[model samples]
Target chain A: MAQIIQIDRPVETSKSKNVIRKTMSICPECMKILPADVFERDGKVFMSKVCPTHGEVEELYFGSYEMYTKFSTYWTDGKGALSPNVPIDKCACPTNCGLCSNHLSHTGLGNMIITNRCDLTCWYCFFYVKKGLEGAYVYEPTMEQMTAMIRTLRAQRPVPGNSMQITGGEPTLREDLVDIVKMIKREGINHVQLNTNGINIALNTDLALKLREAGVSNLYLSFDGVTPKTNPKNHWEAPYTIENCRKAHLGVVLVPTVIKSINDHELGDILRFAQTNIDTVRAISYQPVSLTGRMSKKEREKYRITIPDCIERIEEQTNGEVTKDDWFPVPTCSPVTHFIEAFTKKPQYELSIHFACGAGTYVFEDADTKKLVPITKFVDIRGLLEFLEEKTEELESGANRYVIAARFLSKINGFVNKEKQPKGLSLAKLLTSALLKHDYSSVGQFHLNSMFLGMMHFQDKYNQDEERLQRCDIHYVTPDMRIIPFCSFNVIPEWYRDRIQQKYGMPIEEWEKKTGEKLEQRLYRGTLRRNIAKHEMNQMACATQAAHIEPITGT
Target chain B: MKYVYEPVKGLERTCIRNISISSSSDTVRLDEPVDFTVKLSVAGGIRDAFTSDLWEKAWDAWDKTFRMTYNIGIKKVVAGPITKDVIKSQKFVRRATFYWSRSPELNPDYSKKIWVMVVLEGREPVHPKSVDEAKTTLFDVKKTFRVMGSDLGKGKHALKAFGKASWGRHIFGEKGNSQSVSKEITITCK
Candidate 1:
């Protein structure tokens, strides 16, 4: 007989305390729309919803109510997509969402899933071969279908999305991956990024060079933590992958899927690793694991971590190097977009996402102390934003162009504190050049001096908010040429990703017979023995030197 | 009698003298009125680039160009919430304000008509009433505007007020002038 475990429990409930706001969420069991109340308890914000069939479900929404409210102040509604695929009068949100008119933002980063066939079956991954095994189909879109999808994305009006991310079960597994990149570039997408595990890049020496030559601007490398135990997926292979990326001059952004009690403890070490490898690693993006599949409330509570939670962890782990106050919501850059639109009299790329969806801040390395300096340490970011807003409003009100420009040049010095500025960085001059002269070269200089730190928390059915769904700017383009938001596609895979991919996929039996390999046999085991051996040799050399070794002559 | 003319090297060129802003109080009650003064000074001999007749012609051309291109009209007003009849009636006065009040070349008469638009918590632009002015070597204009209690709600608010000098057409490489000074004020609702 199984052993039974019992623990102390308190059942008294008068009235749930600290209700902050009311929103809408979905039932995890029945997937029904339900009224949800957001409240604070134990310093964490949580969403509680009661479904008629599912009973009561609660999930942590934000780690800190104070931080949530502080970031909420930056909220601004976006000028939704032009030429929405669905009419607002016909249907409600989420149900009619191939980017219905109810959506508040256009697609900023469009994702194209080329193949739903990966080489690794990670325990936490949303996409793997198991889905195909269960459904009896292999989801791999044809090149023609991919081209059509890219066309559909570029055809989006008001502002045709200029950036696209090629994603997959593993995009690098495709033999024609370079050709796909070429095709995307041919379609006139300026920024083409690939989301991949670094195993392929590390194993194939010429592959990184080929991708770079094919115009793959950036690689969204999946790197969880520094230690091998914490990141068994790619810890042993990351160094070689990063070195190959450096050799190819391809920029990489470290993407860590942080789960509490698993890899969350290693965030500070991961950040330190990123700083040391800043040349190849452009940014470190933390994604708190979302409970997409079947999960109990207790399991959800144990695993779920929000953006603020990640930020707080980063602060604690980095020993206050990156504090909560240093970060701002992703949508804080909306003013820059607004100003550009007003000045140029054209539609610009707008990031009008919900403030709670993501937060980011840039950290520059101080020349004197060699320590990372948060942008707010030197530049008066809030003051600069206010100034930009004022200037944009003035421009909209028909302010004289020459006079505004001259005044901006003269008063730019007042907004920046020279004494607090980073060593060898003339922030005032950089701001003046970027804002007044519209010279973006200074922005490149700024990036060269700093690294971007950001975190994005995707939602599952347990905590999905309709408001967030309406404001999502990241979308996935399907083989059928429909644009669905990321959370909607992943969270409710049955309705969007699975349904669409099944229509275009082949039967699993046929795929196995034709490919002459079973699904389980196709998983990627690393083949970069030379690079791994070199890395091991370097580590051994360092260890020997640390022990003060001396070479012996012929004895 | 005229002596041999000699050109001086490194002679100082005409430029803007100074721009300054001051508020009546650092803190104000919500839904109450506050006043601000903006002063602009132009260096001497800056207008030497043009004769009086040429300057007048340039000003006229600038005004005509501005009116033709950007003058807010019935169609544009209709695009906003205000109705054409309401605008046509004496019920509303819709005038374009300057970008920056401290531009050296801004017309003094135009600057007098300019007002400071106070934006609080992303609300509608509040046009302040011009109370006083002293135009000399240094041009000064004082204006007042009210902040709504609802805008502040509670606690502290960042009150951003800027003098907008709208000259219609492009001037000084931009459309208008806006003072760069922003003030933060704590508002206590009564």
Candidate 2:
């Protein structure tokens, strides 16, 4: 059975004003009960909870179904995954829709919408950019308006902080793109990143220089796999190859969207590629697919892969260097616990490269001599605490400052008290110089269809900053231009639809309005969700089978 | 005020401005001549920390003859940079004194001072680059009439002595010579 993690908190009425009393989280990974507290800082809401085996549960605000589907398709295509697997949903609130109180409490908003225009047509495009859906999506933002929006945001909040990222179907398509970058620089934004397929960057040196001058901090590059046989053209919707990203001077993040059957065998190759590109590619983010695109239920099932299996594949490929035994259960509040651990066998610099086996990143250390030691076992909460305390002592004496122990302690403590989190700090700080922030590069979720379709659901929520959400600002250079937030095919309110129709001077009422129909008919019929439900039921039925996990107790 | 510089060789009373009254008929309206005196100052930019030693050296320098011959009417002239103008001798006998102002409230970090020079037309030596008569008349006179220690105006130093004078250099590093030129001035006492 899948692990059940639970989180429960007691209420306190002592304070004069309002206070978040308790929060609960159920990890779908390792089943461990965890109590958590919600934190709010600079308008962003965060949760700090740990599953005994999963490590640290540090999560950002929201994720989309569309994104997961594209990732699934890309990973599956590259990995040649053909198994009946389902990647677990990470952001499942018992209550769905926009009314999630947990989501509502978060105020910090950081997002990167690479592009709606892509070079290839994938089977599972989030925005559904395949042949039949040519007119369905329009994701290009005018350079002037985009620059203005960035300026307005930066004027409101400057960095040492987070800023929205530039993405596109591929953002490099616009000719005068460097002007937009210059505008962002004028706004004094601290961090501006690009999410791209890296095709343009690899080919154009001048573009890279202009981007640097315009203050682009990082690049999120889509890298599916190492070999062409493993990542054939039919498997990947886009023409993303490794050679294209090498030309970029900025850091690159390799995102592999894991599909069960396709690229599953290439797990070792993926890790090796990331390790080799440590100088340019700072990190590798493995995003197992979530279902939300043009893929039917049967298709999703064919590519259903979980984060656990992905880690196990890495272990198998690495010859037990990184294994389930090495990974500890990340802390949780529900019956489920997520386990995220890394091998201590690699050198400090190599280990520093960012990889998300999912439970965010957790750092572990030694107990007695106060020397830095590699974490080789899954320690209980008590053992973890003792080890951390000793590590903290070592830090106070200025011994292990070079290692990640002190920062880890602060992160854990700050996560525990979310509201009072530190200023100008990010979950990314725990990462080393070798890792660049991953753009939406994971093939599993960032497939053309997944990106297009997944982003449709987020149209209303994308431009909003952490503190407030409202109708975003847009400028119409054309007198009769229509502003489509998530492209023309997305489910928009009637008024928005009518306005666009009027601008185009098309038959106001005669133009076909087919909203959510393509999605329902093509992808949702036998969706990934149904497939996972079937798999879970099968597992439940085989209760006494060899797959059962024997719960182990600490000494 | 009388203009005099003490730090040069034997020569005194370099430049002076005097106002005189001449009457002819009784009950006749007469215009009185108004005289003006400006004191120039010269000293090392370096400050002398020891009060007694500084005073001894300063007095010795002042006793020396520092004078320039500038053809002008002189009557009851007081040569020195004005520090305090007091009502004396039934006239505004301005006391030649120098003072410094260092208010921490105004400038907390560092204090600064400005050097003021009084130029006498025609009576001063002409600069070599003084192209015109007007320019030469203005350029010739150079002396230190008074040295205002801490933020004082007018009565600071005696600028009548040419020996105590320093030539003004061009910004691009060119130097000018001090010599007499065909320059003359008419002082109409009105």
Candidate 3:
């Protein structure tokens, strides 16, 4: 608590073609840190930096300046980590990124890479190992190492990291994956999720049930799109994977790596698919592709898509059912955390990251019309958030706790329009329970009725803003017992991910000989890519069964 | 990123022909919405770096050779000696990035209710260049803002209004603010 930093937020005006603020950015070609200007032109935000060696470079920082300024209003500086891994005197971000003292946010969700081995090889993926490459090694940590990493995450002060995402090239490829989940649960990770392409989960019917029984909460399934072209990774098997998770009573979050000229067009259909299987599908985490390495300016323009771009496209594709105004930045939840902390008189879990990094909203099915009802369409979300902020300020200013609680109870229902709210949905009551009881079951009840749509755009070298980097909340835990931000972990793999993993990792031959299992055997021959994909209800899940879903490509 | 704006003088070819300023109300009270319109008539145009043809070649040639602002309009190549101090200078810094000479009005504060700035100017629809002695164009910009409680006191106030053409923000370590045309009106604030 003593180490928590208070972020100074000054009012700024970023109208047309104005230097919104000055920040630090690295040159793409030279990687030299230089001062950069984040400004707006033609209603778009772009970052410009002048590298001493690389000269000058400008990249689109965000798509819409209007959305940027609106989101920036909720920009809340996070409570930085109390015990930093790498203690530094000065803030040298994107380097010294082992949750340094200057880092602004604690671990909201810590990822542990179980293995760098996958079933399928995607050209755009940088997580897996390449055979015959120099210093190529199978980066699978021992059970003891994983236990130590989970313990490190649990040791975080203020709010100990409880959510763990076990990610990898393919986590299910490891034979001891269920045991790993058991170990993470044994170490007090309440929510354990497996990040996988889901070929194994779809093929092995018992695996989903086994993992669920072993304390795995959900499957962070890699589901790009519903069609073959957009989701070549798991289009044929994702339906089976969803069915297995349904049977096992496990939740699944569909992840789509959206690219501008690529699979971005299917965003609407993907949301519909989630709604169709809303019983099992909890959320759709749309991740815009982070283009690493250097490339020509023309190439970047072809595939570059920012967060607002995705939300705008979703609005257009969904026929205006879910417009851009419905979505709020991820840090909008900070007010809830603040109010709860002030009420409980202790630090609570908070998602206080840069507002530009992500945005989200929840949608519930209408009882009568069966139409998707976005939370914003019914409730005054901005008004409620602003009210919560006001109440939190009052509580912080020495207002009576019980009086504030009574005032909060009296005022909560004013923000929700009862006529527009979905039937059987009482958001005011749900919020009341969440604030009073503060338990997982209240949130679980909320998740049972609606679907969360999230947009998280990871940064690359060209568009990296160090201000956002210093406040990143999604982190990765390494075997060295240090937590790393996701951008520094994979975006600059040569520095952190690869360097540390290779140190604690072993060669492919050595790993194979020790385990007596060939690395090639880990590859799934698409056994789940059998017939019945066309007959699957996933096509019906996107709710495009009548007009859009074609018989041939499962559109 | 540098927080500076520079003004280029001797653009005698471009000067404000006429200027006027007006407010929506003769008396402004706190939290009252008032529309302010500033109009200026001027000939010629401001220099824009992006529309210039040298923008592409300036990156490769910036370090080896420098180009001065006066010789920038035309494609004629004028060379200057490369000095270490020149690289760190604000002029060189302005040349690389987009530091334009826009006819932007002054912005005092944003906590006011609303501010709508409208500018009327002309250029080629595609790749417009600053004309040295082009047609005289009329610029009318309006901003609707509310008087803040913290800004005004209960008294007779003289509101100084000026329709001037200057660099926006004027942060380039310049000596004094460049002024073109102006007027003042009296208003009572309560």
Poorest 10 consecutive residues by lDDT, candidate 1 chain B: B67-76
TM-score, predicted candidate 1 vs. hidden true structure = 0.71
lDDT of 3 by residue, A225-254 (tens): 767788778877787788888889999999
What tier of docking accuracy does candidate 3 attain?
incorrect
Compose the digit string of candidate 1's lDDT tens values, residues B61-127: 2211111111111111223233233111011112221211211123222121122222223222222
Tell me the chain A TM-score of model 3.
0.93
| Cα error, candidate 3, residue A401 (Å) | 0.7
Prediction 2: B-chain TM-score:
0.19
lDDT of each: 0.65, 0.32, 0.69
Candidate 1 lDDT at A44 equals 80
RMSD, each candidate, Å?
17.0, 31.7, 16.4
Kindly give the stretch of ten consecutive residues in candidate 2 chain B with the minimal lDDT sum: B91-100
Model 2 interface DockQ: 0.00
Better-scoring candidate (TM-score), 1 or 2? 1
Candidate 2 per-residue C-alpha lDDT over A492-513 given as tens digits, one digit per residue, 9 for 90 to 100: 2222332332343222122224
**In what order do the candidates fall by DockQ, top score first?**
1, 3, 2
